[model samples]
Target: SQTIHQWPATLVQPVGSPLSLECTVEGTSNPNLYWYRQAAGRGLQLLFYSVGIGQISSEVPQNLSASRPQDRQFILSSKKLLLSDSGFYLCAWSGSGNTIYFGEGSWLTVV
Candidate 1:
């Protein structure tokens, strides 16, 4: 019975503004957390994942970073956003090899 929550629903930032997106999961502890981005019909690309606290694996090097401070809380951040960063930001949760469920996401548009 795990569910994920991601917020702001939508975000608009300038080319150099900072960014923060939060995701949390209830009903599960130490669940694998994932951050993904989909741009204009493209597939989901993994940004980062954490199997446990202070353990984050990043799949791409960009204007983004992820952290896991709690067993079920995850965050995605950027010191300075970019126009190319505009996309659908998704947070996913899975326990072990189970299928992942995604949140509604925060649509980011950098001007």
Candidate 2:
């Protein structure tokens, strides 16, 4: 019964504005959490991941950062937004298995 939730489901922000996307996992403890971005017609890119509280790994150098303030809570943020930052953001969680569950996803449009 584990689930991942992310929000706001859709966003439209101006360039140079700050951004914050939050994700949380339920019905599981110490699950691996991840943030992924998929540009239009592109494959999913691993952004950040967390194995435990206060532990975060960045898969690529980007304009965003992630934080694991709690065991099941992960936050993705950027001090300023970029036009290239527009994309679909997904929050995922995985238990001790290879199976991963994804959220409904968030659509970000930087104008």
For each candidate in the order shown, give its overall lDDT on alpha carbons. 0.92, 0.94
Ten contiguous residues with the weakest lDDT in model 2: 92-101
| TM-score (C-alpha) between model 2 and the true structure | 0.97
Per-residue CA lDDT of model 2 for 1-111, tens digit only, reads 787899999999999999999999899999999999999788999999898999999999999999999999999999999999999999999999978899999999999
Clashing pairs in 2: none
Q: Count the backbone clashes (under 3 Å) in each candidate.
A: 0, 0
Top model by TM-score, which number? 2
The superposed Cα distance between candidate 1 and the true structure at residue 4, in angstroms, equals 0.9
User: Could you give candidate 1's per-residue lDDT for residues 1-111 as a string of tens digits?
Assistant: 777899989999999999999999999887999999999878889999988999999998898999998999999999999899999999999987788989999999999
Most lDDT-accurate candidate: 2
